[model samples]
Target: MTDLLLNHRVEGSASAPPLLLGPSLGTSYALWDAVAPELSIGHRVVRWDLPGHGGSAADLIGPGASVGDLAGLVLRLADSLGVARFAYAGVSLGGAVGLHLAVHHPDRVASLAVICSSAHFNGAKPWQERAALVRAEGLAGLAEGANSRWFTAGFTVQRLVQDHREADPEAYAACCDALAAFDLRDRLTEISAPTLLIAGREDPATPPVHLREIADAVPGAALLELPGASHLAPVQCPEAVLTALRTHFDGAAPRGMEVRREVLGDTHVDRAQARQTPFTARFQDFISRYAWGEIWTDPTLSRRERSMITLTALVAHGHYDELAMHVRAARRNGLTPEEIGAVLLQTAVYCGVPAANSAFATAQRVLAEEED
Candidate 1:
């Protein structure tokens, strides 16, 4: 609320786990418009504008600022909101701020996702030159080329372009100064929080290799690359960006999806998603959130046990087609072919010979497919 804090909007339940979102330079928190709402369902989403962007005071940052300074401002905003440790995700410059926080103030970040950003902004000379250009002539020139720099050809988000156009010249230049001085390459390995890196394959500002470098350096870090996307991925490919963030942050349906893919394999899950229609979308969500998310993800029973139970239930109900799928899943869960036969035999004794006969035929077909 104070001038010292960055301007931010909060969504979702106050009691939910806190998630902080940061914006790239030349844009406002509105950059998250397409993705934040869905993310807020399971998180206390706080999306902020940089100094002089959106509703933030232009004086929050001045000339010769560092990314560290921007990070400090973000900390102030989080502290003012009574948030201690939070999951963080950011784009470009905002991502740089997250890297700084993860490196310098590890205690405050629970997990991190960096999108279209780098550990070192490709050295300081280009940023220094950009700072000078903005300070001398302002942001008009940059705004004019915003779409090309930020998104793929024939795609545009006018609000972001306008945000670039309206950004305060001095503050924007100060942000450039921050980028000029920023370099966290050596400290990347110091990041202890769980990290994820997202890259737009076509991004000119920071390419996929930048993200790969961080993924290689940070212990247990993961990377995702979205094809056909440019620098501003959330604006250009919100669904992919949102899915990445949600999976990293443990959103309910996304968590289920992760489990679903693990249990069923990517080929099957991808096919299911590809065939999804509006009428079936809710049903799919239900399966992900409940069947996979809650039931399958439960640690109380081993996946092997669940797979056995699933096979019995499908056979008992005479769902032969689904029985084939569960047969495949059973194999994935490490059940031996003989063990699967035992489960089917038990089902025959309890349910009926006719149902079990059909189930065995289906399982035999799926098992043969796997062998092939």
Candidate 2:
């Protein structure tokens, strides 16, 4: 049993793939309670209270504390729990942490799901002013402002009053500092994991436009906009969020190699396992399910056809890490150099010549290595 420190909770099947949950600033793991039951049906959900919030140590604070710090903590937590690789889902501050993890430590993340967060929280003057005010007077000074931006009118008057009334003042203030400093706009393209971006249609804080920006920035990211919700969409509209998550993970097939072996035959599964190191092991389940199960099993397309489609999609979207993995999978699925060239040529017509050109270069590298 891993010692419960820093206000984190572990629940669901031990054998299942792990899901690291990052809560919004000023909120506890309780923020995820409404949705955890739904997610736990297929995942071993691990929820963390960001430092200075909820059950975590209050000592964790200041400019030293960052989104990268949070990502590192989650990676450490997963390691403690024997989870080499896992899916990540985060809300607001948590979402920023997920983005950082995907960009800086791609091997540790299998997939990323971000809710109601933006690459940059606010522009220079406004955010700095808010941070200064929070630091001076604490969260109460920011409460009215936060509430108005975070919830709908009815939700603000009713739901938020109950929730916000209990938040610790110091913790909330520290979170304001964290948000003020958070910025990842220029680095969004560096992330390699398959990503899901969910946003509230009515969320004044992060809005649908922010989600669209993230979708456009991150390669191979899918976006979902929820109706009649606010920044706290995980609580206000848990069903919609859960349903979309279930559908996405189900469609992606992010299962373990052992599970894949049971379903996909010994030879294919064994070859994949042989390639795994400690770092790559973290991504095996994602590769098995998404690469093998979901994409590979679609009867609508042959294996060769699916390989062609996947390679083209990864390349066109600029998901270079995934593109490399699929290029290898393409060969395993029996795609010859000629067939791979044909797919790249076809992609040039639909996905701009430059994108196809870049993909061709990547494909050539993979093919040469395989030949060697």
Candidate 3:
């Protein structure tokens, strides 16, 4: 776990459900001021600075660090706050963190809302170049473009631009590195939270299509596209964003078992439960809570995509026994013989021919028996 202690401020009544607000890469928790006061009326709103930004330390966001690493920092921060589960709203990189928590730490999220963000943030060149420029010339160089991209004239304010200008360059650059390597396209189905996606139609950085891609992927996710709004929709149109959030949180609570079945199938889950014993109870409970309830339940990646990755991994590691079981589960999860073979064939190149050959033989036998 990262020892990053984030600077945070809490608002509203403590008795209310916790609403954790995270800011964009170059901004601090102040990014949410437009909506926080209104949101605090019904919830305990907690806003925190990004690592290396504001009062947070820089050492925690090390080079080549994955999104999960930064996400762990949020979990630790929540732990310190004694918040077991909370609703989340984030912008840009902050939204990415919300996505991470939904996937890796599902039980910790009550509901999620991401604005001007995508599962896979492409265009590594620009992000990398931005980081390089900041390192070379500092925040002043990026300020003008950042201001224009982040907000439209409707709500554009100098203070927000200053937030970008005054951001710690090293920390901002580190966040840029994380964004460059971020790709969760295949894992989108793994998010189990009841989700809401907001997009700015005029935003050049992450357009409505990005929001559409995620909206179409995550099951039952709601989407709102703000006209004339740019990358920072929350800043550009806080009233709309806040309205959607209140409706989403109040509408429905996502069920874990239903999402688990959607991803893993009912028969397979029942069988696994039947095999559980007192000695293995804790293990079963843990995976059920975290893996199935939290991770697999996410609507980010479909069951078929997940099965392919799982089958390939099992074959690569020579976990044939589990592989065989997964083969059956894979079939239930909609993997055809041809698809399974393709995954194995692809695995062969990196894992070795003998492994693929063995996997093929077993997979063929399973398919043939099922057909018979």
Candidate 4:
């Protein structure tokens, strides 16, 4: 069932660390149905439809609502649910909102994951024309444009039925307004939360160059570009996204050299440890070899640098699930809250105020948890 007031669905325990899922522009919470099951294993999942998008009240931001206002609505929804702090994940416009929350309302977020979003949507005239068309007609008027940029032709052919072609017109127009007014290239370094940035390699809407700028600007962000995915990578390649999330989250715990030694290096191995449950054995192998050996051992980038790059990419592309995991990893990698803030400030120009504002709020929430 849905929460009538907040326009959200709650699945899993209230006591668990809340995971707030934000939908992309023009879409509803149904976008998260596939991934929510995987995430619900450990966290309470709260998926919300932004105002004017799904079951929420139909008040558009009028003509002046900012991305920060959208973010504030999310915070209000969480407060309504008694969620003091939560890990946030979002896609597209939702990702922008998550970044604002991290940068400005850091105390409310525990981690951030952003997907297929951009800090700045660029200044192309064609995009503006399309937005005008959507405003004058409806989302249907922009469906072709949205589909071309959002999905690979092959994927769209196969999965067209699942896409949000029937989404609300007013919601789509409001989101276009949010994107149009967003600019945060000068404020990338102000965000202090750890962030993970996930991108679809084939995403034409927010290309690799945008992600590169984000990676370069955010202090402790990491970037993971998934091949064979389009703008909606979370839906197109949920397995890879799940793997990355699991690795980042589990990697946040403090592991002594002794634990590392026992697992990977030469150290005493107890016979009883060998007889542990199959799940435990699999987890050990996953962590030691996949997480540590493959990711942690990569010499191309230091963990600290990776953290910075990841946060920037998240701010750029707006991948909120990975953003949260990276925020937690930033703490493990020794990044301070102030450094995160600096990154958000630096990225303000390239990404935009809406994206940066969300990044800042998410950072604040994650950093506050670290203090607690």
lDDT of each: 0.91, 0.76, 0.81, 0.71
| Highest TM-score scorer | 1
What TM-score, to 2 decimals, does candidate 1 have? 0.76
Model 2: per-residue Cα lDDT over 1-372, one tens digit each: 123455688888999888888888767788787777657756899998866666676655544356676676777778888989889889988998889889888998889899999998876466567656656766664555656677777664433443444565555655666677778899999888989999999888788898899999999899999999899888777767876776565554344444455444577566765664434543664566575557555678876677787888887798877677677777767878898889989989999898888888888898899889
Query: What C-alpha lDDT does candidate 3 achieve relative to the native structure?
Result: 0.81
Tell me the RMSD of model 1 versus the true structure.
5.2
Q: Say which prediction, candidate 1 or candidate 3, comes out ahead on lDDT.
A: 1
Off by over 4 Å in 1: 251-269, 275-286, 291-372
Off by over 4 Å in 4: 1-4, 124-128, 157-163, 250-372
lDDT of 4 by residue, 257-357 (tens): 23344333342233333443433544554555566666665779887887788789988988765566567767667778778788878878889998888
Q: Rank the candidates by TM-score, best first.
A: 1, 3, 4, 2
- Per-model TM-score versus the true fold: 0.76, 0.64, 0.65, 0.65
Q: Count the backbone clashes (under 3 Å) in each candidate.
A: 0, 1, 11, 91
lDDT of 4 at 324: 66
lDDT (Cα) of model 1:
0.91
- The TM-score that candidate 2 achieves is 0.64
